[model samples]
Target: MPHKDTQGRRDSTGGVGGPRPQEGSPRGGLTLSKPSQRRTGRGRAEEELTRLVSEARLLEGLSDSLRDMVMRAQAYLAELRTAGSTLENLAGQEGVEVLVPIGAGSLVKASIKDADKVIVSLGADVAVEVDVEKAKEIIGNRLAEAQKALQDYVARLREVERALSAYRERIRSLLEERGLAGGPEERSK
Candidate 1:
């Protein structure tokens, strides 16, 4: 049983009518929760579905970003491999004509006057002159490291793809259960 106050306010906790509790009417008068505040079972399920769909979209964005990283890592690995190959081919070709890139895959004939030594960048705007063999070794090590990084990126992309796949399946199942399989896109298509 609840109590009423002078202003006719009801106390659901059976005290002097002070403030209404969040739910219930005064001792079984009616289910007096505001219609907007009242959540049906179906409404809660729909909310869950909405939340899942949003999470799937978020995961999809993450997957796209991971894919871009994988592509960049692959391109970097290819460039490192190409540089290593060029260095290996120049190992014993001092004072000979060689094709060198002017820009954008365009090569011009150039003479290797000093192929015995080369300037190797130690990164951060720092470079040191080293013999051809040492430069090649350094490039080889860099190539290996780049290859490993590429592998790591690819592995992470695969993991993201797998998670994206699972999310897609779950989203599909949820939609099908709600009779919204394929959603509006399918109908429009």
Candidate 2:
């Protein structure tokens, strides 16, 4: 229930009330004013701040997850490069012979088993090892870029959280120091 003063007006309940004369307004002046509607404003600001804080925490979690993905991508790229190098070396051994023409714009096929077939196109014949390594390098680079981008996002979210914290603190201090809702002693008794 809202308290009321002797004037039949709603007391200092610190919430919305209908239009009323401003305190100390001259009598018989026919002047009336409505109380400023700030409760909704304050509530909206608090909700926004809470949303920012939650988003910041989510970003932090995403950043951590990205770090793991980056490491795994790097490892996979290294493994692919190593395997490509080994294959190139074995293809150059005595058991490996160029059965077909080994030149640009040509197709070469090596028959290893009765049903196993390996088709080497012009590009593959010339740069099979390099292509594998290049692909791995590209994937690893992209993963690193993604990790850095996620970290940047997390940092931006943290800045927003810090700003919200400052705003909340400022509002709290203002309300406390001003004693807007009666003084501490008055409320206690």
Candidate 3:
């Protein structure tokens, strides 16, 4: 029996298990051993693991930033809610009146007399002129300022949502690369 060497060429007097068989010996009685397989790399796997860890750290930082934004948005909403409640309470308060200009050299002042009846000031000697249109303009400007603040709050909320989405995408890719992604069953759970 003859066996090939590492170079694929047959050598003399060396067979299976380091011993040569006798000439014309029973061929079926010999046993052949297979070559051992080489193990794969460790360095490349380590590098991938390191990259995954760095990505996780970045994801955590983004999540923290998103949380801060959520807190700020909550504070802004609370402020808006408080402002709305204050406006409602002020409207419901006493001593509130709607004054309007009437005909030539005349004015009308309407105030909530009790709960049901509204009282109007009569044209008498105490009649005073007030620029009601200017007053409305001032109130409208203040309301516009409040509206701008509310719009800014909403814009900040959208920014928070955008940053959170980016972090989620990065984490998903990292988990997929490591074969650690929760499959359908895990997701359902």
Candidate 4:
């Protein structure tokens, strides 16, 4: 049972008819575009903004992981470079005793039998014996491929950073529009 005027017009809104409603108020005294039964116009916008913030946080995590991966890749690259350099020096030190790693932080004192030859792994636990020169060439190939792959990962990391920046920019704009908070730069100060 809704209240009605003398002319049978429904009270303001929520009924069959009313005085056509005020220009600014279609549903009631306050004008609002209801996106769903559970949320209002601003509620919907706020929800969207929240979603954007969550996505930005996820991107931040991914960025951290990517940074970790890049650091590890660089470290591995350095190790490979050191190995290559070591091989060159090792060629001159035939019959020299060395600390051969036997896993688990343990080493076995062993003498070099053939400094001109080394074992190279080609992934999947597969390895082949080759001369020092051949091993250097193989290492060079691996280094080249790793460098290229690292570059691609770095590129993807940059893209993620850009996306995160854009998300932050959008969140900042929406917050400013609603007088909620300041942008990143403003918040820093």
State the lDDT of candidate 4 residue by residue for 1-189, as single tens digits: 566765665553356544444446647663334444335557767898999999999999999999998998898889789888988788778789999889999999998998888998889999999999999998898889879878988999999999999999999888977777766787567
Q: In lDDT terms, how accurate is model 3? A: 0.53
lDDT against the true structure, per candidate, is 0.77, 0.53, 0.53, 0.82
Clashing pairs in 4: none
Alpha-carbon RMSD of each model: 7.2, 13.5, 19.8, 8.2
Best by TM-score: 1
The runs of at least 3 residues in candidate 1 whose Cα sits more than 4 Å from the true structure, single-residue gaps closed, are: 1-27, 31-39, 183-189
Predicted candidate 3, C-alpha RMSD: 19.8
lDDT of 1 by residue, 141-182 (tens): 887887788788778878877887887887787677766787
User: Of the pair 1 and 3, which is ahead by lDDT?
Assistant: 1
lDDT of 3 at 81: 59
lDDT of 3 by residue, 60-156 (tens): 6765665675566566556545544443444344566855468797889886443322222224744433233433344455556656665665576
Clashing pairs for predicted structure model 1, backbone only: none
- Is 1 or 4 the stronger prediction by lDDT? 4
* TM-score list, all predictions: 0.71, 0.34, 0.33, 0.70
Residue 152's lDDT in candidate 1:
84
Model 1, CA-based lDDT: 0.77
Candidate 3: stretches off by over 4 Å = 1-40, 92-189
Better of 2 and 4 by TM-score: 4
Question: Measured by C-alpha RMSD in angstroms, how accurate is candidate 2?
Answer: 13.5
Per-residue lDDT tens digits for candidate 2, residues 45-134, read 567656655665665566566566556656655654554454444432544533555778586867433112223232544633234345
